[model samples]
Target: MTETTPAQLIARSNRLGADPKNTNYAGGNTSAKGTEIDPVTGTPVELLWVKGSGGDLGTLQESGLAVLRLDRMRALVDVYPGLEREDEMVAAFDYCLHGKGGAAPSIDTAMHGLVDAAHVDHLHPDSGIAIATAVDGEALTSRIFGDKVVWVPWRRPGFQLGLDIAQIKAANPQAVGCILGGHGITAWGETSEESEANSLWIIDTAQAYIDEHGVDEPFGAVRPGYEPLPVDARLERAAALAPTIRGIASTDSPMVGHFTDSEEVLEFLASEKAPALAALGTSCPDHFLRTKVKPLILDLPATASVEEQIARLHELHAEYRADYQAYYEAHATAESPAIRGADPLIVLIPGVGMFSYGANKQTARVAGEFYVNAINVMRGAEALSSYQPISDAEKFRIEYWALEEAKLQRMPKPKSHQGRIAFVTGAASGIGKAIATRLAAEGACVIVADLDLEKAAAAAAELGGPDVAVGVAANVADAAAVQQALNDAVLSFGGVDLVVNNAGLSLSKPLLETTEQDWDLQHDVMAKGSFLVSKAAAKVLIEQRLGGDIVYISSKNSVFAGPNNIAYSATKADQAHQVRLLAVELGEHGIRVNGINPDGVVRGSGIFASGWGANRAATYGVKEEDLGQFYANRTILKREVVPENVADAVYVLTGPELSRTTGLHIPVDSGVAAAFLR
Candidate 1:
């Protein structure tokens, strides 16, 4: 099987499911039914606005979309399962279409129903197809993925496919992600953006594999997951897991595989399952857990028994689990240390080789990478001999040991930013980027700190000046690096200005199963990181005798009445108050502090789309067209601000614009005062 993309996603209301006469699935837009106020933003989820029916996502637009409510679609599916009253479903859809005239629901909505992620994207990239269909795909996948990724035997895709992924994650908590044999890959995250990156990586990996083989064939195949099945029954069942992730590929092509290669260093690259992942990654990092940090190739003899293989693998896992227990027992001294619920450190499933654990998804990914590197040596040991990443026992114990969990707890506290030159983490993109860019454009020399130094440099470069921007890579949460970034900024830019504490991340997860470490990440960046960057900035600002501004990028979430927003909102509230206190204390020397509240800024480098988790995106109506006006409509000014807009606002505070005002906040949203303000 090869990778694929849907030529068109026709709304059932549109009556344009197929065009036998024309290959393109073309249809008209039909209005959706039902509209309601989004609790978070109060913006109406316009139930009607189907853009178009049939068009490849690569070429999709608002015109290609058909709008329909998740509720209404559920109604239709309710009537149509058992292939019962499909016509009735169609008739009902038609009535809604004629009444609304915007867009119809996609036929594949049921598939999306199965996912727990937010945004879903399915495409048949050429490279992905090649690897999926290759005869020795298992070997090739092993060669490419190593221990970084998990390989699932080829299975027909659909509701079962989504179930497989969900099950895999649960069964193998140590696995980074799973690979679909003979089918394109899938990735998920706490946010829509991270999922998108994971999706892209699937294709990236395929392309890398093809390139390695140096072959190009007419890559085409039947679309795997899109057959019209009895979807209505499934929809009802899937909806139980509120906010389904959905994606449809109209055609199957080889260019759809994920990942390029493990070009990233293990320790440096974060884990796939790590928290705030939606903020950290562009796409899936080189998949390591199931795939190995890299791949392994073995021309096995027919004499090898399945039992023999199972033993070799389970034995390794036993070693891992045992070591993990030992480590936890040793480190469990903290009257039950905070990270008691942490995940396993390492896992080795026989033929699956081995994988390492990480503090966060990012760090776990780093662990996978170590094993991937080790795999290369395994192959070189001899034909029958293979290398494992530090035996199962060693990895398990290391990964699970309480000392490991303690390390995360004992991470260097954030720098006390009292004017010592505040550094904003995540400045490569989003709110942080906006603040940094704003500072540089406004004449204050700004250093863009990001984990990806290249992205940092590019962001600065976009300012179109050398002196205005200095790209410095550092994890703001890391004390030493935070200090180092500050030192570099001081040496190069002279001194720090009002540190615009404007970098933040959010993960929309139901608290029930959300990992323990993820919650820490939210505080680490929003609360802890804020304290560190501001503390450093305070030192420099206080010494200068010049009052400074520290603007934080908080969210409407802080004031929300909801369930999943706990980690983010709580941290935002804490951060906002912290700024207030910092202002009161630092005001003695002219140092000022403030925070900026903005709704989602979807435009201008939408990394969220890059890492989109198909499930959540659809729930919040994070469609492209809706994004432009989504926040705009919610704000008071009826203007949707972007990263640049927020950046400019922060720059103003640091520049001549707001020299007098401190201990205040500017709402970047046009009219969204009620959410965070009132």
Candidate 2:
């Protein structure tokens, strides 16, 4: 057990899991055995340290590795030979832990214990998966690394897989590794360094073998450098389908989809063989567990209208769900529980790249990444011969395995907004962006709605990845546009939990100087825009039957007016009243309506981008640089108001602090006397 301490083992696991090409998030596992004194008996006993269920190897910690008595775990093999149920085996493993319910030892711990080495590494590296899932996996394993590794046929991971692994090790005493067909590879050594190096060496050697002896005839039809049709090029078309797909996939727990149309993704989708290959199955079992066996494919034309696309998507989804039910029926056993859900985790559109779904943006992005990698693995395997993934029965067995189900149950509880979705208008900058950022940080998927699509997308990208936020163009003043945007929010993130109606503009002029154009513009955005966006989002919340929060970014001018600001003040006043009416109407539906009136945020606000601050500073007879100080001095608290100050007020109203209170306006103007709530 030299150099195989828990700390060293964790470090080795992290090194191997760090590279996605090596192993994806929480995809691989490693284990080591060392001797420790039993506290009660005062005797040395072999202790097996394995990665805990649902722990990511890349960020492995001492706590993530569960310590089990090797002798007790190994004894289970003798006690439960030819076990009748997965539950019995899982329970046996749990009993082997030093602490009764400390952390569930990895399902692979049984097999790891039987390995003749002190350390064992099980990885789902793409390079080895390509060979392991190939049609002639046994032949490929024998040909590539002759006598260095043994090849085990496809076996659902459980007590049976562990037994098979032990028998293989007993027979091939000199073999350093075993490649599980249609799964991944495993390596063993007396030292952690050797196990890590041997595992990677096996993968690199297989990849080199593939490179050296090119396939005589590739199986799939893939072309190099096809015409680039980015998803962004058809942003409107893609956005149209987001809400539809999201709604169909939504179960009791909401899920969000991450959209991607990078060049590589586009090239893969554009390939003639993509549809056929994608339908085949996942390249590895780990992936089958994350994403279902295959994605739901749809035919979407770039020019299709939102209505047409929605109708078509609904038709396709019906068929997809039916097929999924058929798949479950075909493979279910008496021991198997009811199928979790028939919803597809991945969706493929002909003209679009790809979209992956999960409970939140982070999980969605992981699905997207796994699917993209699966594409590459499928191509690599096809080139070698045929892309031969595990059979449907095997996939079903692993997907519904009791041990796997327990892993999910044992995971920690989620954050308050873990599966919630939010839409923030004018989120490209200022207070809107801050609110979106805060929601995402709290584990909510966000939609960045703005008039500028490109800028909105850029802001979404900055906030997180495509998974964390989606950007859509919407003129909130236009009822149709507002409705479509709300529909898209539902489609992309399942449903809306919080809506920040923060998109508005200002016009500073005397009542006489404020002409028809200025007056109309202010009222259209501040008054009409708030009404349209709130009503549309309210429809979603009502349909979901889940309570939601709606906050309007009203202005301090609603309570206190400034000279030459009649148009802006009047519109804000309208917004404040609209909140009250909506609150009264939507209260029975469990939707809380609130407002935050902010002032003196001259720096980052979009309303002041057109030299408004300079003009205001001139009126005060001070330099533009001194405007912040002037505003600060005017406030009773003498504090400068920032966009974040406004954003904090929004959180207070939506957060548990005021969960029971609604129809209220919180002022964020650094204690402006006239604007204080009276």
Candidate 3:
């Protein structure tokens, strides 16, 4: 048989990890044993390559594997201080490093190393977990796979658990794997192909059994009046309540949110047993780690007014916080890590759907997905028998595990705009796009709102796909369009925390040459449009009760008395004052309003490229090509300003550095004396 290599192991891991039915995001571990010449001794030595801590299987890379000397790894069993000191074994793995180990070893490293197989897979597939969590799991395992698979009783994953599995494998010579009681499954094979095939067989067989013998309605009958709201109404309600839920979830720390009203979620929410099941919480450690101990479920029916639902949400959130604090107190010991946060990570609304929160968008979205997996597990478990998760004490042990705490502590500090959602008008190109890109780089989820839907979508994709950005079309001058844009933002990222008013068209003309159409067009999009967008965003921001930012990308023309720029100048001036007015009016609600005045952003400016560049050049007696330089020469700083320059000013004004400064304008025209705020 050809020996499995690291590359092949990665391929196998990706195949299994990519499928949700096999395992969840960042939830499983895979390993391969091989022999390589030792760098120091120039002799062949066996090594175990296992997925590292916090690495996801689907995207696993060679660098994400922890390589340990097989001899040293197995030798630790002799010195193992028993289950009481199992955690210390994780640190001891460092001593077993084959070389400069690729990545930090995960706690499950022992499980893979101690198992006497060329390949091993420990997975948390929903189907496998369903049977593992069933009250009659041991009996069911015997009935389903017979002698081919065995069952291991509940035990915290550590060195002892590894020894037990190794012993089980040795004793049951014909057994290919075992169902981990109250956990998941572990499978092994002499080769990588066999390992992957065995894992799949177990998962597929378990699912087949559940499907054939399971009850018709695992979640119970749909409750009256608790049916899903109409599609539009459901979204509208989710948008209305998302901000408040996000705010409540952010009590301990700022968080980004994700909303899901998928068919499965709706069905579960409408089920008679949903309340009881949700309260019992998720069974898998991976599920609860991301979702929290359990979700905070809104008891109100779909018929309840959004206002009533929101009120109930607050009460439920308070109760969840209190209950979480009690859970921590009940199980915490002197050595346990301090309670991380009392705020619930997942919130379930009977009619609307689910809202999951995390420090960022991907995490938030994945948490929601994991909860769905939990839902699946419950459905299958209930159908097979009774769903029984590990005890609270066991869950508490894992949640506050020292190793897990270290992992959290190792996370990088958040970027300045982390957990913020920004809606940027005209974001398909030029200055707006630059601002959106900059904000996204600083960890903000961006809503790229533009008049052109295709261009907006392309730009959003370029920024980082749906997780970091989404595109929405809006004619900001229209109140309905503006409101819809804000609604899209709320649905996309829970709420809008920052608003950038930058969509405008320029038609440079003398006061006599400027027609009524030009004046109205410029004013409607820039002046009134800013007002419409701000008004709509304010509702969400106020509902969230989270202080936010509103920035106007007013031009230097707002202040500079440039010639033949009457209509454009008027709208800029309007936008400038609107910033000040809204700053004062919205300050009570903690919304900061600011403005940026930029000149000669001609190179990449959509306004300039669209005829304004040539028109401005003719007015100044310079070639259109030299227009940017001409504007720069006239400025105090002689350096031509670009869209990125304006973007930098936007970041500074709205970032933590200017947290205390508002109702201000920061000039970004390379020190334009005329544009300076006096």
Candidate 4:
């Protein structure tokens, strides 16, 4: 095997997956031919180890390698004549598997098995595809690489294509690799190192040719000062556009919108030729599975007001959907699957850059990343020559392939809160962060809104990446700030499914000692803050026509007034009454407003850290260390109430289990008799 081991094969495959220029996420495959001891025969049998179906080359593992009997696989070529159907050919390949531990063999296993080399690699490199998918691709390939490379015209990846590749390789013994017109390139050698070297050489060679001969265009129009616009300004605009896009992009499944403004995205958007360039299809045909044939483009003026922009976006979105439906109807066949949803996955805005739409944040961000790389490659191709991608017919075949459709339909059921977005005020730390993490664990994308922007970012990072949890800074008490925070959530995550009004501060002063500022602070956050968030979120939920939740985190003091805590107790009482009123007003719209009363959640809570625990202990003539036990003893259940206890209650209220229950108070205080709902 020329010193090529399984570990080396895996390393090389991972290297290919890790580089976006070489492979787009899970788009490529690699294989190695070796021998393994057969369990039945106890003899060394020839085998082919190919990357498993749906596996990413960047994070490949040995276990991810599908082992197939080489002799049996080779024999399929002879029997393949009668198997005209793709499924029949696929079945024969599956029958050739040697074991059941690994994943299914890659879809390109037939092509890999036909190559008479120890190591084989098929990669969708950006530079190579730019030339391969061009109008004069075959001629350009001959002129650029000459004898070193062979050319294969476009064909669906199946038995026929594999047979063609095998025949071409046999005919061109001097060739090191072959470029599949409008697809990608394949490289093979006696060793993994040699195969990888050949692939790199081909990519580098193509890139160098473009660097030398491609027409370089001045990328984007620059302002007088050349300094980019403030990030906050872009974010503001992106937020304003989020709800409109979300409303327009709704389909069979809810889609989360992720906004991105990377340097590449900005530069591409700023170019004078952006609209024409964007009209060209994806650089690689496989990207159709992620981004579709092309993105929906919009021209967003810098001077447009939020309302005006949203109105324009809504109108454009309707037109985009109509166009998508027309495209579907034009090419659909009897055997083709039902028309897929009309929502465009990628939306490009001139000033706002790009927004990738998906069922959740992870998928959205992945689409964004793919488009960024696509933009870079297409820019180079545009400067060099016309960026000619595959036709709509080819895209339709790949996008709705029966095998892919079946696989996608059989995908595991999503979690309870999949595609759901949640907003949690004061989520930077303590009870808010705990609740946010809990929501994410159940598959909800959470917006961590906090007064301290830095802390909010840190908390979001701690929970997960920006895709799972995003941070927005705002004073919940400020009306304008609350509205902005609501906008932030919608923009970052498309829409809000659950809103947690958990932002509160403790003021533990006697009635005579309490100042006007302290009273206003407590009321502003607990009562006014909850009102503003609920009002804005309710509007969004109504527009979405999807049922949603509004959860108010009230204190036990709302029921039984505590000594020297008039501001905290009175504000919490107001919050409880507001929840009932909101529940009455919003119930008609299918938006549930509920309240959770948690008592003495002293452990790891923001109020505890802000001296509430010490103040309570001092008032009760006990040390702070004994505060938790003191509260525990006071409750009938005699269990100390923690943040998670409150979070669990929130989950129940927000989830479908309690869907029929609204306008009610749920106690999460280990059975506090005085705080019990009467």
- TM-score leader: 3
Taking the tens digit of each residue's C-alpha lDDT, what string does model 3 give over 56-105?
99999999999999999999999999888899999999999988999999
The parts of candidate 2 lying over 4 Å away from their true place are 2-4, 37-43, 99-102, 214-219, 222-236, 251-253, 262-264, 299-310, 333-335, 412-416, 425-442, 447-498, 503-551, 555-565, 576-678
Cα lDDT tens digits, model 1, 533-604, are 888767655544345567777766656544555677788888878877988998887777877776667775
> Which residue segments of model 3 deviate by more than 4 Å?
1-4
Model 4 stretches astray by more than 4 angstroms = 2-4, 81-83, 218-232, 299-305, 451-455, 472-474, 478-495, 531-547, 584-590, 618-626, 629-638, 659-662
| Sort by lDDT, top down from the best | 3, 4, 2, 1
TM-score of 3: 0.98
Instruction: Give the whole-model CA lDDT for all candidates, comma-separated.
Output: 0.46, 0.80, 0.92, 0.82
Which candidate tops lDDT? 3
Which structure is stronger by TM-score: 2 or 3?
A: 3
Evaluate residue 229 in candidate 4 and report its C-alpha lDDT on the 0 to 100 scale.
43
TM-score, one value per model: 0.37, 0.76, 0.98, 0.91
Q: Model 4, clash count?
A: 0
lDDT of 3 at 543: 86
Over the full model, what C-alpha lDDT does candidate 1 score relative to the true structure? 0.46
Residues 1-678, model 4: lDDT tens digits? 433567888999988788788888787899988877788989888888899888889999988888888999999977776435755677677789887737777568888999888888998888888777767888878988998899899876777778788888888888888889778899888888899999999998988988888876725453232223468877777776676667666655677778888888877776776777777768575676778778887765555576776777777777878887887888889999997798788888666668887878978878887787678667656656666777888778778788778878978888878888999998888788889999999989999999999999988898887889989997977888888888878777877889999998887889999999999988888888888888888878876667789999998889986798999999999999988998999999788999999999888888887888888899888999999999999999999999888889888898879889899888888888887778
